[model samples]
Target: MPDAVVVEGLSKRYGAVEAVRGVSFTVGHGEIFALLGPNGAGKTTTLEILEGFRTRDAGRVEVLGRDPGDRAEGRALRERIGLVLQDIAVEPYLTVRETIARDAGYYPSPRDVDEVIRLVGLAGQERRKVKALSGGQKRRLDLALGVIGDPSLLFLDEPTTGFDPSARRSAWQNVRDLRDAGTTIVLTTHYMDEAQALADRVAVISDGEIVAEGTPSTIGGRDIARARIRFALPDGCSVAELPVAGLPVDAVPAEAVPGDGLVTVETRKPTEALHELTGWALRHGMVLDRLTVDRPSLEDVYLRLTEHGAPEHNTRRSTR
Candidate 1:
């Protein structure tokens, strides 16, 4: 299938500092592609370039098979694209229905105002003025306006920035609905879990470049490691004396030895480590209590990649 958006060696500079440096990626039709990164990581700049709001300094960009820089093409391109920007302000005097109706004028075909209001969970509030709504309601208004045109491609920049947990989840559902309806979504967000939940694929950018890209579960080679096993130790048992082969003793913290007889051990190979530990404990007439194993998460991978500093190469594939 053809790509919904394609970027090759895309770059943008601000006199001395480069905001985006040779970034390249593709968003397939009907796929949710997330640009995950921290503040000042060039996510917004990249989105703006694709939206035709900003010009790129170098590289090729194709949106819906047309160059976004061309004015005529850009207008046609805009009709197919819906944008929910990070910072948006609405006229305080305009009611929810009024706001959506006003935006619907820009497109040749727009969804019914009432349907759009309900789609964004603003049904009862449609009569309320923008200034009278809460923060979350305002965000919903932004979404209604963006999707009024029923765009095939949607760019959501921190779509649920200040939303509470429930509101965020609701917004996520709306995104999923769009994807289910064959809309291609390109999302930029700081929340790791949000990216992990909604994105089919993700690209992590740092220092004005993409540093890592992959599925959420295996990004940064995290799945290559084993699970961690934690349990309580019997009285008089020492971590050094624990007969767990292939387990790093250093990974067990000294503070983990509770007065009530608890020990936590982290291992790269949980199966073998658990077998050895269990056998050794039984032989020594000791019992392992509250044993549990856990896998690494996307947060772990993110910290490993961008915690210290940006890597040398612009991109690295996850070792799943």
Candidate 2:
């Protein structure tokens, strides 16, 4: 599929400091791509450059297949791209429907204000003043304004930052609806779970470069990361006394479990270990209390990538 956004060898600098250096990636059509990085890692710098809010120091960038740096082209691109910033400035006196309708006027062809308000779950509250809405409601209003223009691409920066669990989940469903309708989205969030849930693929940036890029499940070699199988120890028993062999597995040595009163098996082959362990327990009539298979989550891989800083080359793969 052709990319909706493309960047290569992108660089940006602020006087003596290099904010972004040699970062490159692509967002596929109708896909949700996330950019994640620790503070000062240049995630925003990269996004700003693509948005044409800042010019790149060096490298190529294309938004909707045209150079975003071109003033005339950029003006046209703005109509196709929607931005929901972290903070929204609005007249507290304006009602929900009024706010969206005002922003809709900027586009060549805007969506119906009523439909956008409904899509954003602000149906009954349309007449309520912006100042009267809750924090979550305000965020939804921001989302409505962003999509009111019916943009082909949407930029969501921490869309659910202050939302509660219920509000956050509601926001996730709205984002999914946009994707289903074929809107390419570029998201940036500090929430690892949000990135995993929404992004078709994610890129981790650090030290002004991309350190890893792949599906949320496999980035940073997470698929091959060792899994820790844990179970509570039976009374009066030591980890050594637990079954170690005589099955189709090479058990991780007992000492590696790392804690007392609970047995942990760290293995690269969790499937086989789990099968052998369960069989042994059944034969001995033992109950494996609190058994859990733990593997590397996106958060784990993200921490590892950021802490180590960027490598010579990013481990990038095709986006699903």
Candidate 3:
């Protein structure tokens, strides 16, 4: 089957700034694709272009097998696309059911309002006015309306932005269910864990261009198995005096001092380093305490990609 969405050398620019620069990627049918970046990274601009709300300055885009910039074609293509925006402003007096029913009218064929309500876990709140719902409930109502059309492609922009932990989990479950039912979902989120949990592929955009694109585990080439290890030192032993045989000298602080009667070390190879350090401490009659190992996360990858200009691999693309 052809891709659900495809772009080639896509670019978009405003008067003084380029909002999107030569960004290209494909979303396979039924795949959950995530676009992740900090604020002002052009994620929204890229999504807006694909959604036909904005036009590209250059390049080509095919969404649902139709050119998004063509109005007639775009309207037809939109029937198969659902959009859940980050901010939803609905009439405060409208009930949840009324809100969804109103949106369902726009699509030729829409899922049953009752089913959408159930799917989003808003069964009991169906009669509640929009103004009466909590923040999380309001978000769910937005999601319910977004999917009511039974769109094959769903655009979820920060779907769970204001949700608490439990509500976020509930929203994740709904997204997973949609994917299982063969919905092609394009998501934009600042929450790394959400991307890691829901996205089959992720593209990191910064300064109007794609800086990196890959699976959440491998984006920016992060090694998931590698860990950073830090440990506190014991009393009477200078950090410098701690035998640093196997540890990288630079990994240890130059002016390491006793903190709560312990020294600390950071290492990429935690398992090997910990074993060696433990053995050395045992041999030297010292105990290693407060040891902790942490793995690099998607947040780390996002920071690395955006903190600098485009990464080395992304340098070939022109910024403007």
Best candidate per TM-score, number?
2
Runs of candidate 1 with Cα error greater than 4 angstroms are 231-238, 246-264, 275-292, 308-320
RMSD of each: 5.9, 5.1, 5.4
On lDDT, the stronger of 1 and 2 is: 2
Tens digits of per-residue lDDT, candidate 3, 230-251, equal 5666667766676677775445
Clashing residue pairs in candidate 1 (N, C-alpha, C atoms within 3 angstroms): none
Candidate 3 clashes between residue pairs 3 or more apart in a chain or in different chains? 232-263, 233-262, 233-263
Considering lDDT, which of the candidate structures 2 and 3 is the better prediction for this target?
2
Q: How displaced is residue 113 in candidate 2, in Å?
A: 1.0
Q: Per-residue lDDT of 1-320 in model 1, one digit per residue for the tens? A: 77999999999987777889999999999999998876677776787788887789999999999899778797788888998876576789989999899999989999899998888888899789999999888888888888999999998877897799999999999999999999999998878899889999988887888899888877787777657677886678677787644455434433365575566666676676778788888898998888777767787777776775432322211110
Q: Across residues 1-320, which tens digit of lDDT does each residue of candidate 2 receive?
A: 67999999999877877878898899998999999988678887787777777788899999889888888897799999998888878889999988888898899999999999888889999899999999889989989988998999998988997799988888999999999999999999999999999999999999898999999989998888888788887666677776687533545645524454567787888888888888878888888888899888899899988995542322111110
Error of 3 at 284 (Å): 6.0
Q: Indicate the worst ten consecutive residues by lDDT in candidate 1.
A: 311-320
Clash count, one per candidate: 0, 0, 3
Report clash pairs, candidate 2: none
1 or 3, greater by TM-score? 3
lDDT of each: 0.82, 0.85, 0.82
Model 3 ranges with Cα > 4 A deviation: 224-226, 248-268, 281-290, 308-320
